[model samples]
Target: MCTRYRVGASGKKLAERYGAVEAACDAPGVEAFPKRRGWAVCAVKGELRLGTMGWGFPPPPNGRAPVVNVRNLASPFWRDALARPAQRCLVPVTEFCEWEGEAGRKRDRWFSVPSLEIFSFAGIWRQTAAGPVYAFLTCAPNALVAPVHPKAMPVILHPEDEARWLSGNIAEVLPLAAPFPSQLMALAE
Candidate 1:
């Protein structure tokens, strides 16, 4: 549901929720065809660096629709992604935008860090022929996100899960498939 996000390392930006910052998001580049954009940490081009990644992983191998989301419930890459080493990534944003209120026409609201400066949204990534495309992982929506964009929650990683998510087995990382604490989330006007 969160397609737009603000990327930065400042505690003031993400609401002081994010702890470590190995790398900040790479600003979008100017190109005729731009890659999907979001904060990420993955082995792109054989390098594990934190930066903004394109939303869609790539033109699918099976000619599937654009893989913009790493949906655990439906993404074909779910099993593969979970099995892949350290597919975990994060999104640090000042505000996440979403539409709400109606079934046909909705209004967008800007959600920012309430008590902290910045926070990381749960995500996953995979290297593609074009580059490293990311699919922000999602689970069942919580009470907070339900009213706004009711579908799923990002794969928020706990501080303890960071190391393991970046190195542990699929079984080990599966437990992180939940929404972040509601206390840490706030809807932006």
Candidate 2:
């Protein structure tokens, strides 16, 4: 579900890479955890801007848990965000971790796109009562992530698709929710 990931670069570097204006905020650190603030590039007033947003949405009415990895686009909870380009965001990431092994013995397995020093996940953000929060989409795992996290993997966007994800209509961006190419990804030792 990508509960944890690494940014691995300064805010200035990330903003530069995404062609966004940097916000005056503290760095989110190398490793990011759920509910913590992390850097996200969002379109504001038709301009891409980089800023920090808390991970995960506020708990739903049923009080299940904070929504993190969004997989169901048809759900009422996520539909509005999916239909609006302004709510779409780019989650900067260097590497993401998935746990392997049994409950007590599980160990983290990190994966990264070998060709990108920094890549982005297809994300969505919203203004909640607690403030702005963000979550990335997930899809069925690929050959590389399936062994470690068979259920799902974050939707890592290709550099070319980043713009489409942020501005394209639902029809244009929905197809991008598929898994990234396994051959282009590397599992860290």
Candidate 3:
């Protein structure tokens, strides 16, 4: 799961690239961790808008920490949030990191498609009592990520497919949820 990722561009550049308004809050840098406030391009009332949102869903009623990765689309926990296509958002990232090592000796390795300066994760967001919260989807890891993290990796949307992910129906977005092409990604030590 993508518990951490990187967002290095300024809000103005993100807004311009994604055709959204500049976010009004601070943007994260090379290392954005879960539960932190970050900027995402979300459709507000059918218009794409860049806004600051916490990178997690609200804690469960039992009061657990917020969840950062959401992979179960069929689960009741996310059904209401995922039902509306408008809730979809694009999480801009330079790369995402995965840990490699034993429990206390883990080291981070960053992964990205070097051919593109920026990319987006298929994300979902909603208004909560705390504020707006957003989380990205994850899928089984592809070859590149599987060696480092055998479990899963964030579902990255290709630059050309960003609009479809943001506006497409469940049927359209479902097909786009697979792991990104492993050959296109590069790893950084």
Candidate 4:
């Protein structure tokens, strides 16, 4: 799963790409991390709006790291948020990172389109006592990511599917929640 990602484009470009109205809020810089503020595109009252939201859901009572990558929509923890289409969001990412090797010796390798163009992750958000939080969905890894992290990869949405992801019903979005094609993506140094 992707715990870190890069969104290199300016807030204005992100808004333009998704046809969202820019909100007068502070946007995150090139690199984004868990618990940090970053931009997300969500439909509010049928209008696309771009704004900032914290990276993960509120931390569990045990004080472990907040939940970041969401996979099982049927899980009780995610059921309410997933049931509401209003909470669905699109997380624009230029690239995402995965760590390889032992914990102490782990190194980073980035993944993105071969051309390094912007892409998006299928996401969901919700209001919490702390504030609004968002998490990107993940699925089984594709060939490109299997060697590095065989468990899972983010549910990267195609550019053309952005609107449907935000507005479509469960059936329309379910078919799209799979690993991206390996041919269009590569590991960046």
Give me the overall lDDT of model 2. Answer: 0.94
Candidate 3 residue lDDT tens string, 76-99: 887766667788899989888998
Candidate 3, which ten residues in sequence have the lowest lDDT sum? 22-31
The true-versus-predicted C-alpha distance at residue 112 of model 2, in Å, is 0.5
Q: Candidate 2's residue-wise lDDT over 79-183, tens digit each?
A: 999999999999999999999999999999999998999999999999978889999999999999999999999999999999999999999999999999999
Q: Work out candidate 4's RMSD over C-alphas.
A: 1.6
TM-scores vs. true structure, each candidate: 0.72, 0.98, 0.94, 0.94
Quote model 1's TM-score: 0.72
lDDT per residue (tens digit) for residues 143-166 in model 1? 777777788656555556655666
lDDT-based ranking:
2, 4, 3, 1
For each predicted model, how many residue pairs clash, with residues at least 3 apart or on different chains?
A: 16, 0, 0, 0
lDDT of residue 22 for candidate 2: 95
All-Cα superposition RMSD per candidate: 4.9, 0.8, 1.5, 1.6
**Cα error of candidate 4 at position 181, Å:** 0.4
> Which candidate's TM-score is highest?
2
lDDT of 4 by residue, 20-137 (tens): 9999998788899999988899999879999999999875576588899988866778776766789899998999999898989999989988563778999999988877889989
Alpha-carbon lDDT, every model: 0.59, 0.94, 0.85, 0.87
